[model samples]
Every structure is written in structure tokens, then in C-alpha cells.
Target: MPDDLREGRIVIVGASLAGLRAAETLREEGFTGSLTVIGDEPHPPYDRPPLSKQVLLGRMAADSAALPMRRDPDAEWRLGVRATGLDPVGKQVLLADGESVTYDRLLIATGTRARPWPNADEAALDGVFTLRTRDDAGRLTKRLAAGPRRVLVIGGGFTGSEIASACRERGIEVTLAERGPGPLVGALGGTLSMLAAGLQRAHGVDLRCGVTVTALRGNGRFTGADLSDGSRIDADVCVVAMGAVRNTEWLAEAGLAAGPRGVACDAGCRAFNMYGIVTDDVFVAGDAARFPHPLFEYQMLSLEHWGNAVTQAEVAAHNMVSPEPARRPHLAVPVFWSSQFGLNIKSVGVPTFSDQVVIAQGSLDERRLVAVYGYRGRITAAVTVDMAKWLEYYQGLIETAAPFPPGPGAADGRPLVAAFPVPSNVPDPKGLFHGPTVALTGHLPDRRLTVVRPAD
Candidate 1:
């Protein structure tokens, strides 16, 4: 290993889960470098998953969701200060407060922010909200406690759906509008999405599919919303759960392969320059990184899962201090879970990346089953509704690239063979109102390699 990799200045550009985990792993791996963590938020790293679930439901406090540190990394913390720019050649990160930090190695894990409502004026209304940070969750929690007459959620993604579920749990009338045919269509595809729609509707959610919120009606406070179908909804609160926008604007002129999607990187976590050249000193991880995965035919995957952040950060930290021969690839199978409408939905691998899906265990009619996804006869992904126990088994099949339409014996005691597979019906990325939690951005497994940029 190089001496500089062991003892040198290291700066992490995000103080969130990925950055914190990377710093801890670096110290654990014997990297005695001068470490610094930069964050835009005023508080230390906190758990975001609960912000939409327990926090909004009043089961947990927003401020109490701080992530407990495994060990002190003994690094300088720059909280509430944003990194304004990056000078890759100069090896310095320019901050918002006219400060710069030089580093021998840099970890870019700035992550993403909630995409704001398109109209700035309408978004500023009293009841308009978007949940991403602790402050956002705290404000929304207070608002929900006040018992608004009706809550209108603009997008039917996971966050939006969860918000609606919370509203329903509070006995508040909630209307969810989705531009697609059903909820979760962008991530789980059309088949499972149908089940999601049914669940939402069955649970007292006024689920409106194939409709867009054309305008928000308000007078200092939100009153209602105009829909595309020439109908107006009277709601006192509105949540724009459109999705997230990658935090890569600061690196726009840095010449890195960064854009709206995310910063491009190799499977080894090395960031790529604008010319597509890999740089050794700089690495990327978490939701802000798009890296290729060999298991998915080397397609560059952009993941926003909590597990991905921890595993990828560890891999990046290991590679940052280890020699090329000892560096390992970040090949962890993508996994995600959601709780809504009294159903525990979990998925392994990229469900949208598959072309066909089969019900492996339980029946969809029962609303408690595992749906296995495949592409060209290869098991690619699996999704379960209240059937999380088999997630690990399906994950192994995906990791091994097991044959799709898996054997009949894999099911429970029931002798159920692989059912006839149906089209997954994944939507086009451009048409999606919300970003997918797991996105396969590179070429298809059967297709040749191609460079896919955010613009393309």
C-alpha cells in the first residue's frame, strides 16, 4: 500500500450516512489520515427513513432520530456549511462561507435533496410541504397533528404513499394523485403497482390514477388543487413528493461525470472525469453515485437504499486505503423496503430492470406473496408483500444470476410451479414524475456497452 493512502488528508463532502460510515470504516481499516466531514445541515447525521414513517405518524420525534455513532472517527466537522464548488486540479473544496479545504483524497457523498414543487409561488403556500430533512418532517408532523380537513399528495411514489398512509392512520382525509396508471409503477412495474393501487384504495386513500396536479390553489394558505382532468380537489394541505434531485451542481464545472442523475463512477467506487477517465484520488458512494454492477450485466445502477449506503461506503473506504490488488468491488445486491396500507413490501435486486415477473410464493389475490422478476430466463429481482422471510433466498438467486422461472421446489410446502410470466411494464425514465429508488442506467444485459449520461 502507498504511504500517502495510509497517512494523508482526507475530506468527506457529506456528513450523512454514507460519509459517516466511510469515515468510521477508514479509521477501522487503519487509515490514520487527517479527516474532515462537511455538511450543509445544521445538525449531525440523522436517520431519514423514520422521518416519513414513525416521525410523521407521531410514534417518534424528528429530532430524536439522530443516528448513533458506532465509534468516534476523530474528524473535524463542518456542519451547516455547504460546499459551493470543487477544484479537482487544485485538490480543494470551496465552501459557501469563502473557505476552502485541501485534501489528498476526497469522498464525494453529498447525496440528494427533495425535488421542490415546480412553481415557486405555489410551493411557498402555508400548507405545501416536501419531506426530506428533519426540519421538513417536524413541520409536517405538527401540521398533521392539527387535523387538516384534507391532505393532497401530488405524486404516488414511496414517500408520497407513506405520507398518505400516515394521514389515513391519523383519521385525516387524504387524496393521492399519480400521473401513472398506478402507484409505485416506476419502481415495482405495472403488475405489482396494480396491487399497490388496490392496497391504497382499500385503505381509505382517495387514490387518483392517470391524473396530474395542474395547479395549486391558495391564498397565503393552500386551499385546493386543479387536476388535469378538469377537476378541482378541495384540500387544506398538499405534499409535493415528486422525488429527489442529485446534489451535483457544485461539481458541474469540476469536469467530473456528474449531472442530474448522479456522479458517474466505476464498480470500484472511483469517480470518472468528464472525459470518462477514472481518477484514483476521488471516489463516490450512496444515492449520489451511479456505478456499474457485474451481476446486472455491468449496468450502472443508481441506488437510494440505506443498505447500499453502508455497504458502498465500506467498499469505498477499503479501496481508498488499500492497494489495487486488495481493493474489493461494491457488488452488494440492491434491496429496498416500504411500509404502507398495513402491508410490508420488500424487494431485492432491480425489479424494474426485469422484463417478466412470476408469482413464486403465495397468491397475489391473497395480497401476501413474493413476485419474482426475470430477464431473458435469468432471475433478476424479487418483491414480497408481507413475505419478507424469503428475501434472503431470492437475493442469493439474484446474486448467482440463477435461472428465472425458478424451480417448483423453491416454494413453500405448497407444490406451486412457476406461473406464466407476464410483462413487468416498467415505465420510461423521462415520463416518471418521481425518481426510482433503484435505477439501471447503463445498457441492457443483452446489449453492448454504451456510455449513458444524464443528458442522453
Candidate 2:
């Protein structure tokens, strides 16, 4: 077996944001190794957040969303090539072009893809699009700029909401259909998400709550959408802003503990086998990894957030080159942001992990406040809208396992509630936009841990 990964070839899958950052981190850690980064997309590593925002709003071109290199790793880049299989025994990755990449260590950073609309025939319509890749954004942004009669945005999630915001900013009429009671009900719960619903409707969006898109009707181009509420919308353009789907299908036969959530990994980013045994050389990172976080009840979480992609990649890269004793675990708090309809929403922590929410600062009606999420008398997450300054204080509470609703000095000298009950029926995004592919399985994580060394 290879003694260490200081010199031998190291291959990385998913040459997107996380993949490029990991390569840079590998070099920064003083590892002079042969690195090969593979991506299914032709473009080099690019920033995805901007694709949904600036690119879609026509402020920036999608092709120009390439992320500035954090550090010069100078690794071999394999773009536009699909990874077909992984041969763990041979330490080789099978490429779709019938080529094999042998490696001493492997990093899986394949993040996720945009969940497309169901009903393949309907999805293939001209104006129907899903935003995920840079190319997808380029196409959608240009299409949105064409000034369609009415835009139909399916799903009230962040992506869909952002797209609707962009369309409204363009002065185009938009119809947002959500099966849930309110916008962002899946992530921010019913109480806060109701504010989002009001915000969208006030901005001239035909916000239809408690209705799902039944079908898309168009010959070759999108004409309109059929709703589950026995109503039809005349939509010339439709944007499916469903969440994400983890790109882990290529590892089906690798005998790794991978499922719909993602490849199971330890806090140290070490990939586990199908039998729940950890491997020494195979590591997982980015959105494709479902690892345990101490802050979230020690439950294995699969996050597709942008901050987690860079944080976890650096941790995986460092652990890949360092000795076991010198290695570290990735316990970074999950943080994410989305700008939509003139509101800047930021979240620190897993909002879904909480059972209750409270208004910590400002009022929801003012559209400038923070909601603290709690579960079982403990703070689990916090969401702020245009009030990000107070988020840091709440983030500290979450990290130290602070109590729910917070104590005195938690906010700006305001009274704190101890048992703030989050509205119990925060609709599941899967239930709202059932067609989007992003799914975080609601299963008790398999936390069975095992330590192993290379065979003699």
C-alpha cells in the first residue's frame, strides 16, 4: 500500500467550487503531489451563487462566473468528462471516455445538480428551465431578459424565490406557485415564511399559496402551467428553482456507504464503506458528503450550502496529507445566504433541525429582523433578513450549545422568551415542490463508527 499521499497521484472528482478549493488546499498543506481534477462541466471552477443572482439578473454574464483562484494549485484539470465508476481495489477512477485515472488518494467533491421539472416531455419545452450549471444560468438569464408575457416560477424555495425576484425586478409579471402555506416554509418555518409571502405579494408577484403545478402545456415552447387548484396560469416562461440532487450515482458499486443523502463520511471527512467501515485513503467533501456535525445533535447532515463547500474541502485536504494524529475534523457551522425581492436573507445553522422559532430582534412585519430556531430547549439555528449584524451573537449561542429563545444579553437589551414554539407544520419542500430532485432523507443516521489501518 502507498505509505502516504505526499508524492503519489491524487485525483479529485467534481471540479467545481469545492474541488478547486481542495486542490488549492492540498498544495497549501505542502503536499507536492500530482493532482488531477475532473468535472462533468466544460468550464473551469466557477462561483454558483452569482449564477443564481447576478447572472440571472443580467448584471453579469454566466460564462464569466469563474471563481477567482484562492491559491495557485496548478493542478491538471479534466473538464467536460464524466466519472463513470470507481475501482477502490485498484485505486482507479473510470472515466466515461474509457480512460482510467489511477490514484493513491481520492477526494469526492461532486456537489449537486439542479432538480429538474418532472414529466420529461413537459420539461423539454423551450421556456422551461432549471438553474444549476453555469450554462443553465446563461441560458435562463438570456431567456428571462427576452421579456416574456408572464413568468411562472414553480417552488418557493430560495432558488425559485430568487428567480422570481429577478423577474419582478425586470418589471415582468410573475406567478409563484407553492404547495406550502407560505414561502420559505421548508427552511424558515411558517411564522417567518409568512413574512416572505407578504414580501413577494407586495412586490406584485401573483403568489399562489397551497397549490402545486399540475402540468406544463406547450407544444415546443412553454405557454402556461396547470395548477393542482383547478387553475391554469398563462406563463410564457417557467423557472423550476427546485433545490439540488447530490451527484453520487457513479459510486453505486464502490461498496461505499452512499445513499440518496450522500456518501457517508466521518467528521474527519474519511469515507465509510458499505459495511460501515472507514477507509484510509478515500475522502469525501462538499455537498456530496453527509457527515456528522456536533452542533446538530450529532446527526449526519448533507448540506448544499456554499460556505460548507469551501470549509469542508480545506478540512478534507488537510486530513488527506496529514498523519492521523495531526489531522482535524470539519465542524464549521453551516451558513448560507440568498438575495431575493430586495431582501437579503442569511442563515447560520440548520433551520430544519429546530422545532421552534422566535423573533430575536426587530419585528417580522418590519421585514428587518432575525428569527431564532430552537429544538428541545436548545438553540439549533437562526435566520436573519437584512439584520445580519445580530446573527453573529446568535451563532455564538448555537456553537456553545446555548439554550433556546436565548437568555439575557442575547439581543439588543430586549426581553427573551425561553420556550418559543416554532409553528409545528413547517411544510416539507418535497411536499411543496415535489418535482425538484433535492432530497435530504429523514432517516436516523447510521453513526456506527470503525477505525481501520492499511492491510499488511
Candidate 3:
């Protein structure tokens, strides 16, 4: 006999956007069980995309940007309480208050947080921060309000680039340092990042590419940073947008498969233990779950995008209360977007997985076009800047596993160029993951086999 959906104790950890969505879906699926949500944050889940843009630009209040609930979930909201530990044998979650909540079924959506500067003495410096939570935005926003003389932003990824864009929009002087060759090389590619460098320079940004911030110097508060190219900038503030670290440390002894990458999960969102054995009652989602994807040779992907969180959460919730026959798979294409350097960049598929890329539409000269990436002889990813209307077309190509290096016809008669530049992997600023941020790492595919989407 299958478990009854009407009455099983369900506990959700992390209280993030994904956690909230799962709670709502559980109730919608007619699960009337005792439900409780545990979180380290004091407030409800809020939208995070705006933190780098609107919040920094003084356009939106940190609290006001929170996502509105579709309906009252009615679950016991354990706000501000952090989960200290997890005991799979007892099926209980240990809270900071020394309270334990037992559950027949559990969902882990812990997600990730910005990885701060490694040195404690350096991280403790004033005006140095990382953006992840609403509270983080609030503090940074207030600091930006003070109108610091100069801002030194480290890392040139989406978050860091967006912060620079906000500064430029505010007429604030900023110096951006990237360990990679250019701004978005870690995510997009060095080829496209060249254009990004151009955008920044056009807007009068002190964009320093292919250089690193070796050390942050300050007496007690942040005053300046030393660059790898033998240069120094005396700035009043510094923001470390060096990427994120998965928040799965508490699950170490929980007997689950958690590691530096993220928790390993199957297509149906069922969590795997340290030995790779799938669990029946435990599930995982969001940036903390590394599930395999067909587009990237089925290697597990750990994504920090907003769409992945919502989509993966729904899949986990549905599978939680449904029979095996009724369970669905999470096969959503990995996509992400960012607004920086006065350009709206949207990407579908994993660009870092490709060995070659071509400007399929618009024109690189104009800085408005879609670039298609290919691995071996198949389409792997697509990136668009300003010209986003054509992304849907290329997205269809990826969804259908279309041919590699999509023809100039993909341009839809925009214009033809002789050739375009392909990109190479550029590691993070901290030199943690030497691979590209959107890495193409995976098992070598059998050349004889064609790419196929996995079954649910």
C-alpha cells in the first residue's frame, strides 16, 4: 500500500523561495498533513534578482520586493530559527531552539549563499559585504545611499557586473576587477565578454579585465584593494560578488549525499545518500540540488537562477504526495538572465559546455545579437544581449536537440558575418572552481549515440 497523502508529517527546511512554493503545492495537492517550515532568515522568502539592480539603484525597498503568496499556506512558520542538524534515523530536524520536529516526509531546499572573502580579518572590514538575503540588500543599499567616493567591486560575474551597472547609473565611480579576461567570461564566454568590456568602457567604468584583487587592505574598515597588475584603488567600499557556496553543511551527518558541489538528487527530486543510494522519503531542490541534465551530457548541474528554484520545487512537491506511476520528472532547460552595462542579457541552455560558438543573429558590431554554442556537433547553449526576442527561437532548437552551430538562417536574415569568436573557460576570481562558472564538465559521450532527453 502507498503512503496516505492526507495525513503524513511533512517538514520543509530552508524557508526559501523554493521551500515556500513546495508548501503551497503540498496544500494544493490535497495534503492536509501537519506541516512546518524551518529557516535561518527572520522574514519570509523574497525576490532576490532585484537586490543587485533596483535595490542598489534606490528604486525598490528590500522588504517591498518580497514575493507575494498565492494563498495562506497555514504551515507553522519557524522564522529566524536555523536548522542545526538533521537526523535521518529519527526522521527529525534539529532547530536552534533545541526543538525537534519529526516528519514522515521531508524536503531540503537550503540553496546557497555568497561565498565571502577567505580571510577573516579581511572579511570583517567595514563596507565589505556579499549579497544573498533581503537583509544583505538592505545593508548594502543603505551604504550605497551614503554615496561613497569610490566603490571597488571584486569579481566580474553577473552579480558583480550588475552592481557595477547600478553604480554607473547612479553616477558613482566604480572600479571592477575580474580574474578572467573580461566581465562575463566565467558565465558567458571571453568572446562575448569582449563586448561587455566595451560596454563598460563606453560608460566610463574602470573595468579591469584579466586581473585579480590580490588583497583587501584596511585598518578596521575597508579603504582599498590591491590589484594583481601592481595597482591600488583607495575606495570607501568593497562588494565581494565572487559567486555562491551551497548551504548543505548541516546535512553532513544526516546520511545524505552532500558535498562541495551540492546534494545529489535523481530526476524525480529524490535525494541520494553519500553512497549514491536514493532515499524514499527525502527530497532536494534549488541551487543546493545537483541533478543530471541531458543537455550537458547528463552531468549534475547546480544552478542559482530563480526559475530553476520554482520549477524544481514544484516537481519535488508533486512527487512527494503522488504514487510512483504519477510522479513527474524535472527536465526544464537551465536558463538565467542578468541586466548589466545597459544590456539585457538572457541565456538558455549551458553556454560553458560548448567548444564553439557563433553569432547566429543581430551583429556583434552592434552589440545586440544571439550567440549559439555547440559541443562536438550538437547545440548546447544560446546567449542574447538586448536582442532577446530571437532567444525563443534558439531555445526551441535546444529543446529539440537541434544540430550544432545553428546556420545563418538562425539569424532570420538579419545580416551575415565572415566569422565570430568562440569562448574558453574562465575560472572564478577566488580561483576556487577552476572550471567555467557555467561549466561543460561531464562524462564523455559515445560519438555513436544521439542526445536524447531522459524519461520521467
Candidate 4:
């Protein structure tokens, strides 16, 4: 490795969890380069998972969620400045403030933003909220603390489910609307989705599935909404938890394989140009990266999990400094967790990549079990509800490509559930309102494609 490569200028866009971690890793890896971290938010990088959990429950202040730095990266912090353009040929990042920062290597860590309500007029309503950034959490937290009559949460994803759980914990009236058959179906498949729906309803949540909000009713402030089923919800507050939009629009003309999905990259975290040629200088990590994994049939994965961001960032950073022969692949299995409705939910691998699921251990009726998901006949994913302790074991099985309907000794002589291998019931993303935590990219086997025939 050349000393010049080690001491060259490295710029990271998006001063987020991924960016901060990558910066720290670079310095730790003996890189004495001039580093610059850029962010659009005025505040420095902070933990976002808490925004939907402890911050909303009043267990912690929104402003107090700043991430603890492992060690100072000694980088130049360019806060509150948005990167408007990228010149790959010149290795320069154009800023919105008429400034351009040149870099020997660039890292794209621009994560995602909350998908707003479709209706701009209704979204501008005073009582409406979308939780993403610290400011968003603070504003929504204040609104939640005001003791509204009733709160309506649109979407049934993890964020929406957590918001509803918080409202219920506060003894507030809350209605949850999910356009899918049940909450979390798009992410965890049907077997667990049913359990999630039951959990929400049992906890006093006015759960409404298979329905969409047709209109948000308000003159100047959000008052209520009308559902597609011709039902009216008169609530004091409305929360749009529809999902997230990747921060890739700004890179449309950057000559990279960047789009609504994300920037396409290889397993080693090297970004691919629009022509599918991998670039050595440009890299991507966090929610903005769509990298291929060998386990899931080489399908590109877009993971929005915190663990992925940290691990992938470390890999990207290490590769940034290491020579070609010493570089490593970012092959860590996707993992995510959520605490809602008094239940700790954890998932491993890509559940949406599976076709069948089996109750390998515990019982759904007991609300404590591990659901193992399989594609064809091999283990692809596993989800545990209140059985997170066994997650590591399942993760090992997935890594080994263990056969579905895991054989004896899989659960330490504990009898597997009678409801063995069943359809995973993973639905189409377009049909669901909530965005999935781990999105399996490339051509999905379940999605229908119309064949256009030329005139004979």
C-alpha cells in the first residue's frame, strides 16, 4: 500500500451513523488522511432508533440521543450542508452553498427520509407528523405529550407499530391503519404478521388492516381522516409512517447506478457505475447501499437495519485503506430488532427471500417462538418473538444453509410446533403500504411480469 493513498483526502457525505462509524474506523485503521464529514442536518450524528422508541415514550429526550463516539476521527465536520452533485471524473462533491470539496476517495452514506403523506395540503397540516430526524422526533414528542384526543397512525411497519405502542403505553386512544392484510406482513411474512396484529389489538390499539387513508381532513390543523373503506376517523393527531425514501435522487446524474432503490454495489462495498462497472474510488454503505449477497442467491439486498450500517461501514472503511489482496467482503447476515406492544421482536437474514416458514420452536399461541423461513428447501431467514436468545443459533443455521424443517437436535429436544412448514406468505412490496426492513432486490420470484409480444 502506498503512503500517498493512506494520507490522501477522504470525504464522506451524510454525517450519519454509517458516516460517523466509517470515519472512526478509517482513523483506527491507521489512515492519516484529511477526512471531511458532511451532513444536511444542523446537528451532528445521533442514534435514530430511539426516535421511535424511548424518545416517544418520554424515557429519553430527543436531543439526548447523540451517539457516543468511540474515538475522535479528527475529521472536518461540514454540518448542515447538502451535497447537491458529484463529479466522479474530477472526484469532487458539489455543495448547495456554491462550494465543491475534492476527495481522493468518497463514501456515500446518505441514508433515507420518511415518506410523507401523498397529499401536500394535508401533509402541511399542523397536527401531522413523520418521525425520522431528531427534530422530527422532538416535535412529535411534544405533540404526543400534549394529550390529544386520539392519535391515528398510518402504516403498520415497525415505526408505526412502535408509535402506536407508545400511545397505548401513555393510555391514549390510538388507531392503526395498515393497507396490508396485517401489520409487518411485508417484512416478517404472514405467520408472524398475524401474531403482530393480535398483539396490537390485544393492547387496546384500534387496529384496522386492509384499509388505506383516502384523505386527511383538516382546514389548518389535522383533525381526522377518511379511509378507503368509507370509514371516518376523528382523531386529534395523525402520524404518517408509510416508510422511507432513499436519499439517491441527488445522485441521479452522478453516473452511478443510483435510483429510487439505492446505489448498486458489490459485496465488497464498491459502488458500480451506471454501466455496472465497479469503481475503486467511490463506495456506498448504510441504507443507501444495495449490495449483492451470496447466501440469498446473489440477490442485491437493501438493509435499513442499524447493525448492518455499523458492520458494513467498518468493512467499507477497512477496504478503503487495505490493498486489493487484503480487502474483505461485507457478508454479514442482516439483523434487526424492535420493542413494541410489550414484546421484543428480532429478525435475522432476509425473510422476504423465503418461500416457506416453520415454527421450529415454541408456539404462536403462546406468543413466544422462532419462525424459520426457507427458500426452496434451505434456511434463508428466522424471526423470533420474545425468543431472541435463540437468534444466534438460527443465524448459524442460516449461515450454514441448513435445510428447512430443521432436523432433530435443532431445539435441544424441545418439540417443534405441529404447524410445520407452511407458506411464508411474503407479499408483494407494491401491495403493502409499509416499507420492509430488509428488501431483497433483483427480480423477485413472486412478482408478476407481463410479457409483451411483438406483432407476429
Error of 1 at 325 (Å): 1.0
Where does candidate 3 stray beyond 4 Å?
414-456
lDDT-superior candidate, 2 or 4: 4
Instruction: List model 4 lDDT by residue over 1-456, tens digit each.
Output: 235557799999999999999999999999997999999998999999999999999999999988989999999999999999999988899999999999999999999999999989999999999989999999999998999999999999999999999999998899999999999999999999999999998999999999989999988999999999999999989999999999998897899999988999887898999988899989999999999887777778999999999999999999998889889889899999999988999999999999999898888789988899999888889999899999999999888888877875687686677546889999988878898887777842322232322112
lDDT of 3 by residue, 285-382 (tens): 89888887766677777788788999999999999999899998888988889998678999999887777787777676898888888877778788
Pairs that collide, model 1: none
Could you estimate the TM-score for every candidate? 0.96, 0.94, 0.94, 0.96
Per residue, candidate 2 scores C-alpha lDDT tens digits across 231-259 of: 99998998887677778899999999987
10 residues in a row with least lDDT, candidate 2: 447-456
Instruction: Report per-prediction Cα RMSD to one decimal.
Output: 3.9, 4.4, 3.0, 5.5
Q: After superposition, how far is residue 4 of candidate 4 from its true place, in Å?
A: 3.5
lDDT of 2 at 421: 53
Q: Each prediction's Cα lDDT score? A: 0.89, 0.84, 0.82, 0.91
Best by lDDT: 4
Prediction 3 TM-score vs. true = 0.94
Q: Sort by lDDT, best first.
A: 4, 1, 2, 3
